[model samples]
Target: MTAERTRALQERFGNALMPTYGVPPVAIARGEGARVWDVDGRPYLDLIGGIAVSALGHGHPALVKAVADQTAALAHTSNLFLHEREVELAERLIALLGDPGARVFLANSGTEANEAALKLARKAAGPARPVLVATENGFHGRSLGALAVTGKESMRAPFGPYGTEVRFVPHGDAGALRAAVDDTVAAVIVEPVQGEAGVVPAPDGYLAAVREICDAAGAAFVLDEIQSGIGRTGHWFAHQAQGVRPDVLTLAKGLGGGLPIGACVGFGRYATAFAKGDHGSTFGGNPVAAAAALAVLDTVENEDLLGSAARTGAALAEGMRATGHPLVAGVRGTGLWLALVLTAERAAEVQARAADHGFLINAVAPDALRLAPPLTLTPEQAASFTGALPAILDEVNP
Candidate 1:
């Protein structure tokens, strides 16, 4: 069944879809917890967790019920008429962050949430202060507004004439950030953890330094936690661990579990920047999406998945480190968010071999393999992967 589906999909959709992603042709039919069975009846432990989007895993009962109930009752009512779910979700998110008075603008993806954050920062800065500073190797999104601030030259080079006057500063360099962001700057956008940059975390005191600089310059501090938030890092929001609060925070990826949802949260003074018609989205806060996000939150809290992620992740990291596998240079990151740096250019081979061993991982870069399994992953599952790691590394290296 899987092979047939794969063949049919490739034949009918050959090159029709964008070529951004390579072809693997795994026909996934259903998923539960941390395991997914391909159409061919092959079960694989999902470690990427849909690129860190499936916080509650696939087809979770709570999430399914939330979507079903909300869609039947009120799927969408447009932005003109307010719905209860949007308000409820916003309140829940703000409360989760421990910031009650924060205001939220909903969107459908991390990039869109970031787009809204960029707009809010620009609006708050006025015409005189139009410059935005972003960290190198940081990724915001692909939209023109978000793309302008993304620091990857490879991605930005193709999209010339970007809309914003953005400056790129070195990640984890507070002195450079302070120098770049001044009174003339509108905002300094940063990622608490550089997810796409192979799970590079900000240096100690870096976020706080950025906060201080932004405050001194009267610029908005926008923290992009799209991939690091929602308990991926064992924290409701990664920035919370750093004891720094940003003027604006963007969230998505894992927010809706497997469903699509994004939010731009503004705090205190930044909250009031978007008044009346400043910005809007047609399906930003649709009831179904909000319900899904709520379900994800509920599952994380009720099941104590945050604590699980921390414990399991620590164990996995320790085991990987113990291997002393020459190919494995080191392990970095916290909670379920981790990356293994390889000494050679065999990360892709390791990923493919791991798949053959019924484990799915991501070779995010040539020398980096990223792992963000479902928060509900069991100790047995973690052991299974770590136990197989030495052999996988041997296969790749030998």
Candidate 2:
């Protein structure tokens, strides 16, 4: 059945589908908790969490109920009329961040949220402020506005002439950030933890320094928490761990559990920059999506998932490190977010071997394997991964 589905999918889709993603492998059918079953009924323990999007795992009762209830009530009313779920979700998010007055602009993905943030920053700065500063290895999104500010050349090269007035500063270098974000700059965007860059974290005082610099220069401080927010880092937002507040905060990824949703949150004076009708989305803040997100938030709070993530993540890291296998380089990250660096140049081989052993992980880079399991993961499941790691390393390293 699995082979038949794969064949049929390939034949029907063919080259008709965009080649952006590589050839597909197994066809996933259903999921529950941190486990997913393929068409062949093979179960794989998911550690990537759909690339950090599934906060409550596959099918949580609360999320299922919220989505069903809201859809039955009012799935979408268009941005023309305000909806109750949207208002409630916005209020919940604002209260979660301890910023009651923060205004929110909802979208469908992380990139769109970032696009809204960029526009809001530009509008706040007016026409005089032209330059926007971002960090090296920092990823915002794929839209032209977000892409223009992303630091990776490989991701940006295809779409040249994205726009004028954008600068890149070295990540974790506060002095370089200060020098780049001058009065002419409209905003300085950063990711508290560079998720795509092998789980690299910013240096101590980096965020605070950026906050100070942006405050001094009157530039908007925008933190793209798409991957690091929604309790991935054991915090509602990773920037909170640094004790810094950004003027513009973009969130998505895990926001909707498994559903699609995004938001650009503006604080203090920046919240008032976007006047009526300045920006909007047809599907943004759909009642169903908001309900899904609200369900995720409520589940996290009720389950004490944040504290569980921190405790389990630390144990997993410690267990992996205690292996002391020569092939194991180190472990770096916080909460449920982590990466296993390998001394061998065979991260891909390790991932394949792990799959053969009924585990799922991601080789985010050639030498780095990333793990972002669902916040609701059991301690036993986490320990199972760590126990199997040494053998996986042996198979690859041998």
Deviation in angstroms for 23 in model 1?
2.3
Q: Compared with the true structure, what per-residue lDDT tens digits does model 2 show for residues 1-398?
A: 33676667665665687776665555678899999887667788999899899899998899999999988888888999998889998999999899888999989999999999999999999999989999888888888888898899999999989766788988999988877877899999999888888898888989999999999999999999999999988888998889999999999989999899999999998899999888999999999999999999999999999998899889888988998999989998999999998886788888888877778898887889999989998899999999988898888775
Ten contiguous residues minimizing lDDT sum, candidate 1:
1-10
In angstroms, what RMSD does candidate 2 have relative to the true structure? 1.6
* Model 1 TM-score, all chains together: 0.97
Once fitted onto the true fold, the runs of candidate 2 whose alpha carbons sit more than 4 angstroms away are 1-16
- Candidate 1: segments with Cα more than 4 A from true spot: 1-4
lDDT of 1 by residue, 44-91 (tens): 999999999998888888998999998889888889999889999999
Q: How close is candidate 2 to the true structure, as a TM-score?
A: 0.97
Assess each prediction's global lDDT (C-alpha) against the native: 0.90, 0.89
Cα shift from native, residue 114, model 1 (Å): 0.1
C-alpha lDDT of candidate 1 relative to the true structure: 0.90
